[model samples]
Target: MADEKIKKVSIICSKGSLEGVYPALIMANGARMEGIEANLFFTFFGLDAVTKKKVKKIKVATVGNPAMGIPTLIGAIPGMSAMATWMMNKKMDKLDIPPIDEFIEMINAAGGKLYACKASVDMFGLEKDDFMDEVKKILTVGEFYALAAGGHIIFT
Candidate 1:
């Protein structure tokens, strides 16, 4: 298996937080960079990463995130989420990590396919126009499975 090349990857993004969303984007971008076909499927809160109105505002979840190294009580304090988000954004910016919107554009430009979950879209009462132009289709789970056939499935 180690010798076999990956032909495709189907990445599922189910959370909207910056921490949740970036992993999927980074994986998809890296896959495309390696010449592997890539598909990003947004569902549940993950739809925020694709939604034009919410994409730019994705924030870190300071509360309940032990990785932040802060107490949950402190994380729950007012403005803590925003402060953590700002600090993280600054660090990422310094590392040259593109913003979420720009990262998605780069992935799309690199030939990675973007998809919205049909069930989630309906649940959220969102339409095609609500998503970025990069989203190629709103797909049912079965349809996404079809597209993912023969590829590795990654749920981030």
Candidate 2:
């Protein structure tokens, strides 16, 4: 146990909302900060975080989000999601946290590998050009499993 070492980490980002996405980003960034190899795998709705157009303008999920303390019906009111997203962004800014796009760029520049789920990309009609250039490749589950072997796997 004393000689155990973490050589790599794979963080699976499965949800698209701001809250769903940040945990994976933060963890992958933290892993790299500690000199560990980190891989970020974006799938399904999570693909929003890697898409060039949506990456910088992601919204918080107000509707059906139990953490918000509002009724699901009320949460669906117009502008609720926008307001929540704004509030979260403001809080993060005050805390000196980078915006989503900038954070992704920072992680990429730090050598973190970013990947999109191939099936999702195809199902969603997303071309390679639709994603941020920082995404290294689109991978199927089997490929990801193989690549992530021998290290920790985190699902956020």
Candidate 3:
């Protein structure tokens, strides 16, 4: 019989905004569910997703997005960020989707790897202690490629 092939996937997140952040998280989580060996590498603005100080503060954008005009207008009225974030969380909950933090937890628990880009960490003036405890390592581009090579690489 032929040897079984292992599916590997690497997800690179480079944006900090709410919409930009979720896709990477969701995709990594999905990869784990499929029994794939998944790696999530956070870079640049995407570092916010794993920063302890910013992870819990993630908010939905009510403004700037063309599809969000009405919500943005309503959100600008008063206490909109909180409201929008709450609504977004509620919708996600209804869909049985965990929060980003919990999603990361699930992925890690499933044996997926989480990493932060060293260049981004330096650029953001972040130390190793500043990242989430789940981060398996801080990797340079070369090191990341070593892990990602021969696997599917996705950039979000």
- Candidate-wise lDDT, in order: 0.96, 0.93, 0.86
How far in Å is the alpha carbon of 12 misplaced in model 1? 0.3
Query: Residue 140 of candidate 1: its Cα lDDT?
Result: 100
Candidate 1: tens digits of C-alpha lDDT, residues 1-156: 799999999999999999999999999999999999999999999999999999989999988898889999999999999898899989998988889999999999999999999999999999999999999999999999999999999999
lDDT per residue as tens, model 2, 31-124: 9999999999999999999999889779998888888998999999999999999999999989877888898999999999999999999999
Candidate 1 ranges with C-alpha deviation above 4 Å: none
Off-target runs (Cα >4 Å) in candidate 2 are none
Better of 1 and 2 by TM-score: 1
Candidate 3: tens digits of C-alpha lDDT, residues 65-156: 66766655675776776787888889988998888788778778988899999999999899988888889899999999999998989999
For every model shown, what is its TM-score relative to the native structure?
A: 0.97, 0.95, 0.88
Candidate 2 at 44: error in angstroms? 0.3
Clashing pairs in 3: none
Candidate number of the best lDDT: 1
Q: Candidate 2, clashing residue pairs?
A: none
